[model samples]
Target: MGSRDLHQGATMTAMSGATIHQVAKAAGVSPSTVSNFLNGRPGRMLPETRARVEEAIRHLGYRPNRAARQLRTGRVQVVGLVVPSVANPFWGAFALHLEGAALAAGYHVLLCNSARDPERERAYIDELWADGIRGVVLCSSLPSLDHVLPLVEQGLNLVAFDRTAQAGDPSRMVNISVDNVIGAQLATRHLLELGHRRIAFVSGALRSVNRRERFRGFRDALENAGLSPDDAIVWSGAADEPYGDLDVAGLGRRAAADLMRGDDPPTAIVAINDMCALGVSAGVRDAGLRVGQDVSVVGFDDIVLADLAAPPLTTVRQPMADMAAAAFTHLRECVESDEPATGRSLLMRPELVVRGSTGPVPPPR
Candidate 1:
């Protein structure tokens, strides 16, 4: 039959509830062949047969009954992905890459935004576990993993992203992240090399593991330069706020304005991320100061917009695609393996990308 005729047939069959047997008959193949296609075991099947089955499925809009499949196989073809906030483009980009990897492996991603709240993270994970999702990629980077320890102990295949493995973490847990400390150090050292002595570190909160590490790296860089770490300015007015993710850019802008108003304003600012860096750049203009000339600004996470900024931000680059692929690969291995889970941490290196937003310490203003 022609494609249109097959689609019409499928519509009628779907209205009456299509089944594997019906699909097999429509494809002129045995039900076992259809089963093999659904189960991802069609490698041995002839190319034409596989194509026929795929076409039949597409024309029929056939969706496998996941409930029945799970009942029989005790597994679901879906994985959970929990991110801090999609407001930050960094997290959104990471999610896109991660989803791409998941789709290629024949799995779907269920994304949740937790706003860096531990309780919310635990609740979402609980829901995912209850829904038969055995694997998850959590990107909250919370300082402690205690909230979800119970679920992890119960055999949830979890891959923590943007957070380093801690001593108290479960033995089987997988942690994947760019080396935040080194990344921050690279950003700060670049500023120091430009002869910027009065530097400031700007971020929302020093609560999360990654943020804390970045702060430490900033301090380490300052100390390495023979400058007292305490001499560097640190702005985190929103430290007590729970919804900092929603207004990261605003926070950076505010920090910039307040710092520039001071008598000993910093010659350079190291923002938490590119979003905040963009905000800082705006704030610099608000204070009637040129970004690259008056006060250099450096940001972490070389997001797409970093290059599009008015002055083109100089920032640290995370290998987002590679990290996403690694996270998915590790999670899938844990999900499909029959062996006992073993804990592992993957720390990817980051590179510094210089752009127009930073420059030599503006000849002491």
Candidate 2:
């Protein structure tokens, strides 16, 4: 081969392992300029310079090393989502909407299930932080966020969902939730208007912040109606369980059966969520009672199933898609901001959707 041929061969070998430096050299630009273009922050670069970089990348088959970039910047184009459980379909729907919002903003999500375990949630946040993730949307709704406070102090932008802000939360943490107290009051008031004075509140455990607020709302509505809150039967048989996200339906079914068998059975039931309400309906059937007639049922979190259940369900509708979008937008602002800002709480109003499952209390049997 001639000398020219040997030179061309050497150039080909070098191009095979092209780096950012080589791309900058070929494009006649500085490495920092090339970096800015690659990172989607091409600020005030002349059009021709960008074209040259694009051409160089195409010619050399250059691929940016994301891991190396993350290592240097201490952040990535990905956020973490730690949820309590995926077994419940409401959570599944929320995840879908949150992922949609993240994709639109040029970011991806890493989802983890903590089953409402504080230790597990803390561990997941720690792992994400170690992996260079600087933002997270936590949906555990644990009463106290003390477990994850240390990580938040270290610059983790956290958005707490399905839970209201608490006194102990980090100053820079965002909290987003439907007003649980009002939502529950709406549910109970609907039953009260239906003349369901013998009402019962059913749930797995009152351990989480949201659950506690919901229970409080149930009591408030009863007391405001000139009825003794103490007269309401609260069945929280699974309160001692670690986390009852998966078996909530089962818990509701059992509560219904036991409550219905009592000497003074409740005329109406208020469930924690739609899944639990569906189970309660089934239990009412098992007791030879017809839902919406012999016994009334009301639920929270008007998940899709609520509309499709037999006789449908009366539920409190949470604006899930809107809430998810807001979570992403707030978390992104925190992640991209140059300086940390004081966090804010967003309390969305809930709508009570009346359906076939709730009706006036049955005539004296």
Summarize candidate 1's per-residue lDDT along 1-365 as a digit string, tens digits. Answer: 13344454455666756678878988999988999998768896999999999988887667777788888887887889999888689999998998899999988999899998999999999999998888999998987899999998999988889999888888768889999999999999999999999999998877788888888899999999999977889997564666468888888899999999999999999998898899889999999999998999999999999999989999999999999999888888878884435878899999999999999887655
> In candidate 1, where is summed lDDT lowest over 10 consecutive residues?
1-10
Model 2 TM-score on a 0 to 1 scale: 0.91
Query: lDDT winner among the candidates?
Result: 2
How well is each residue in 295-346 modelled by candidate 2, as lDDT tens digits? 9999999999999999899999999999999999888888888345567899
lDDT of 1 at 63: 77
- Overall local distance difference test of candidate 2: 0.89
Question: Which stretches of model 2 miss by more than 4 angstroms?
Answer: 1-18, 25-30, 39-46, 59-62
Prediction 1 global C-alpha lDDT? 0.88
* Cα lDDT for residue 311, candidate 2: 85
